[model samples]
Target: MSGSREEQLAAWTAKTKRVGFRQRNWSVVRWLAALTVTLLLAGLAVSLLDYPPALAAACWVAAAVTGAIMLIWFFDPRRFRARPSGIS
Candidate 1:
């Protein structure tokens, strides 16, 4: 509780990142699953509300693309590593 702000932040970041592989994988799975369900619900709601076909399809495509990007980004190994030098 007495460290400089940068020291405190580094300690916190290290602590948060100290999970085992299994735990990290589970966390990723849960995150993606929740996003999938939310997107599904939104898509369904849009369709039920009788939005124009193009609009509804666009919404679904956007949601799907966003989710795909997130999934890929989440599993990017570089993100699990420590920050590079000069990066605060």
Candidate 2:
């Protein structure tokens, strides 16, 4: 019985191993990039429209930070980690 349980668990893990993880990560990166671009454009518009310099600077800074995070997530070496046994 113990052997059978282990086998079943192994099969289940194999079936679901890293399922949707890559898709979800890519989706997150896409959204982050979009947000960064939007912020950057907003900053540019604000500056062009003669808005407060501080506000425009804040927007640009936020865009830079989000862009950095997106790049980091995209280039990270360790992408996936297996779930602990019996936790799924």
Candidate 3:
């Protein structure tokens, strides 16, 4: 309420960019952990249940592919493009 709208927008944009940068830097570690968990869960499910081998393999492949795509998106700088700072 204090600053002009443009000033406020710029401030918010800067803060978001900073946070995004930090996340990007740590994304590799996060992605690894996520993949590890996903694989472990899939393995556990397959082992504990009576799922068909083919079905279990398919599900594991699908989950792995989806996670990989998401990981790529998460670390992609282009995907996190900040709004133009010309709001004034």
**Which residue ranges in model 2 land beyond 4 Å of their true spot?**
1-24, 80-88
lDDT of 3: 0.68
The candidate scoring highest on lDDT is 2
Question: In order, what lDDT does every prediction score?
Answer: 0.68, 0.82, 0.68
The weakest ten consecutive residues by lDDT in model 1 span 17-26
Candidate 2 TM-score versus the reference:
0.61
Q: Quick one: RMSD of model 2?
A: 10.2
Give TM-scores for every candidate, taking all chains together and pairing residue i with residue i. Answer: 0.47, 0.61, 0.43
Candidate 3 pairs with clashing backbones: none
lDDT of each residue in 20-49, candidate 1, tens digit only:
222234466567667766776777788999
lDDT of 2 at 66: 98
Q: lDDT tens digits, residues 1-88, model 3? A: 7899999999898887766533244555467658756875885698569877776776677667767777777777765545455542
What tens-digit string does per-residue lDDT give for candidate 2 at 1-88?
4569889888767777646223235677889999999999999999999999999999999999999998998787564444456564
lDDT of prediction 2: 0.82
